[model samples]
Target: MSRTSVPPRRARTALLAAGALVLAGLGAVSVMQSPASAAGLQCSVGYSVNDWGGGFTANVSVTNAGTTAIDGWALTYAYSGNQTLTSGWSANWTQSGKNVTVTNLDWNKTLAPGGSTSFGGNFNYSGTNTAPTAFAVNGTPCNGGTSTGSPTPTPTDSTSPSPSPSTSTPPATGDLVDNPYVGAGVYVDPEWSAKAAAEPSGTKISNQPTAVWLDRIAAINGANGSMGLRAHLDEAVKQAAGKPLVVQLVIYDLPGRDCSALASNGELGPTDIDRYEHEYIDPIATILSDPAYKDLRIVNTIEPDSLPNLVTNVSPRPTATPACDVMKANGNYVTGVGYALAHLGGVGNVYNYLDAGHHGWIGWDDNFAPTAQLMHQAATTSGATVDDVQGVIANTANYGATTEPYFTIDDTVNGTSVRQSKWVDWNRYVDEQTYAQAFRTAMVTAGFNSSVGALIDTSRNGWGGANRPTGPAAKTTLDGYVDGSRTDRRFHLGNWCNQSGAGIGERPKAAPAVGIDAYVWVKPPGQSDGASSAIANDEGKGFDRMCDPTYTGNVRNGNSMSGALPNAPLAGHWFSAQFQELLKNAYPAL
Candidate 1:
């Protein structure tokens, strides 16, 4: 999402005779083209690095200016003579000294008529502008020159754009960095709670949830603090190479909570709420309420699906009138939660997105509208004129699961999954575009506008939404089921949670839509839902290794029943991993 808005690359002032693509004006053959001909294809290759883990990623676009589609082509270029390809994809290559020959694979082959192809790779560096020489296509020289040897496009010694501060840098006010737990909102057990408490704290204000949780976050720059959640997350992200990861977390315990049925700290409801208010929530409110905390960006959920489930269950009670009808009664619950934070005085510090269950999870009419109204009423109850919450988030933890994907136009699920007769009223999963449109439309109808919006979990959507077909092979590749008999070889590393197969383009456009506030990752990747390998089915230890490493795109140690951070399962320790994954997903170009 951090894209550079600089002007497009211009033709190198100094052109080379060799790397130049000469259009013969002949049939089909436009001429010999060079990699430099493509936008962003720097005549010289080097990155403006911000830190060890973050830097500019090189995108080498090789357009087949030639009329015919080339089945396969190779890119041969020299780095600054010191830079190395950290990792690459879409093509393969062998490096010999300064000359690296990159060959396109079957999937990357075939440049269509008047069509162009682009292949990119990244390198790990920590400084600025180091140019290389002699780029070629399949051994043919490129740059701004001809096939015969010529001086490569000479890069001007002019200053290149400076890189932004690395996320490794400590959190400062007004920073809009991604929360590692960006997309995580799901059911987490008490074990995580116990583990989180037991984990050592690096900050003096350990009582403060923000301080305690983010103590290790700053260490992402390198090893800046005691090894805690961030360390494990860093390891997992590194293991993922450069792929984007989405981690999900469900904060079930709110203490003094009404939805205790869905979750309990195992502590008394009122007493637990006491601890949460003073020890956890209050302290978090204090820090985040500060202008400093507001400067720092992270996704914070006021509560999970408790409100929706409560309304769905209690709204029908004979005594209940239209829930959000008046702030005096039904709105009190939501306002009470908002009041505690509003009292903290950190407006806009946290992105408070309430829960809007998946289309399959709740109804659009009574359920969705009433919930949104409660948010408005809660703001009124607190005597706060501004909307306290951002927007409603749907599909909290249910990514990759076929049971539910996005909001439905019609109430097909009707708050239950048991009926086998329910058919999807419409089929929109044609592409990412369609999927995104459905999500936007559904939320808009549900009253999510510029001031409010939704967040989708992209993790586990890499394969089609539904579980892969039955059989061994089905269970072994990117599409294989997580619990199927097939070995763990099915999931994709970067896109495991992104159901791009739904044929929907990116949803909730980068900019906020009218009435839609911010659509961000509410669920980050890597946290487990208590299924350890030691448990019943393979589902047990599901938290074990992020998917079996035997699987194609695995990220962590599958053998360790213990989750990624601070060794074995720690209550809130998984949050650390989720946070770190969100950072990687958000700042991949870094």
Candidate 2:
């Protein structure tokens, strides 16, 4: 399905301040401590502002200092100057004359003792920008308000019956992996740091170093070997200091990397499968298993777009490329992944999540089962057990909706059932949730560990506001009307390189739904998916036609589509324009 393009609206991009600051023109600032508290419920607000001439971006963090947890929270403050809110994130922001109020979202309403959640905003001012002085939480004054009365005590019912003992089993301890990279202690890549500095005052893309992509064995042995993996691990361990330090690593440099596409070609030839195991996988395993870093929890996302290509792109025809023939003959894709899993799985602290191609790819009838079987084979091959894999990740480095609001498992689209559609056919019928659940069931039934979980990369799937549809149109045969009227539809499945209308999906959350472990930003926000055009680089990847905005290429169903996104930089490089667009169109309206 296709739709006529609607130009993205231009507005002040909002940013959430739960972590490192990337305010325009401002260097990294330490978290500001709240002033001395008043006597009532002890709530502190940390305020930070990044000023750029007549405009500035601000982030406020609310900390629960009281002994009890509050079910919901609201904060009110008045700007000292003529500041007007342009946009905000992580909460509902509103203004009454000079006073501005921020309310918590449903998922973040509960504020536990010592726990904190933050909200940010961009604003324009006439003359001066001054931080708000007065702050109140839950109708109580803060930063020095006198107690109005004794603290409210926990409530108890007067005439209620006694509760019965529970028969439910408690969830497994440490079952939920703590993504250390989520809030404050995440690693910051030097490249991201530069990007943030360069584009301060612009829409801040989450350039925080989230993962280290190892594309070649030489990256492990060079002077900056392991692509600074060890240094980041050391930093994470030190920052964690006995706490669970979760570090994400991407094992991407396979021989014939991205076999179906040219954008992410790796250095290794198809014949280097043995070298991949000994030089790349083995050394990474050694680093992870080191006794010093034993406490570190490693969340390894094994190659993106690798296994899926093997299933969909490799051909049985005699005309298949030499690389494809070699890859299939040597079992490089499956065996290489199996070797990494086997080696890494041996480490007690390591948790592996195999990439299940996004809903757009694996949602198809033909792709889902085969992908699951492939994951099962790879996980169990080379001495690796299904236990080596914790779950299958969907929508990795792809733009797929988190939920298809218009359709359910029983729904049909274009005369095809949602559950029975193919990648080329039902690109819009299913979402990540439906696809992940079905894929999980398929993998488990295919001999994978039954306890395997599912993850979705929500870093950039937020298609919000006017771009988001309310429902399918009635009495419409036009592809534009069909595609345009769908509530959760993306711009185009044919274009994956920094999709123009894509926005930030749901924020990182733990176990948001059944069979789902977490909604993670596996692909760090703001990093280029691939170069806009082919350029020479040591990373062993080439330019993909999809990254070129002008190229007319073959899309699904013999349709033709353009491969270009006008302003996107090369994959892995930072693009400010895309970052701004993501924030502006953030799902849930930021």
lDDT of each: 0.35, 0.64
- Candidate 2: which stretches are off by over 4 Å? 1-194, 201-209, 218-227, 316-322, 412-429, 470-472, 475-481, 487-491, 555-558
lDDT of 2 at 144: 45
lDDT of 2 by residue, 167-259 (tens): 001111233343223342444444445555576443254443456666666554332422345556666777677765567677887767777
Best by TM-score: 2
Candidate 1 on 435-546: residue-level lDDT in tens?
3334544544544343334455333223332333334322232212222421111222122222112211122223333323333333333343222122332111123233
| Predicted structure 2: clash tally | 11
- Kindly give the number of clashing pairs for every candidate: 79, 11
Error of model 1, residue 140, in angstroms = 78
Compared to the true structure, candidate 1 yields what TM-score? 0.37
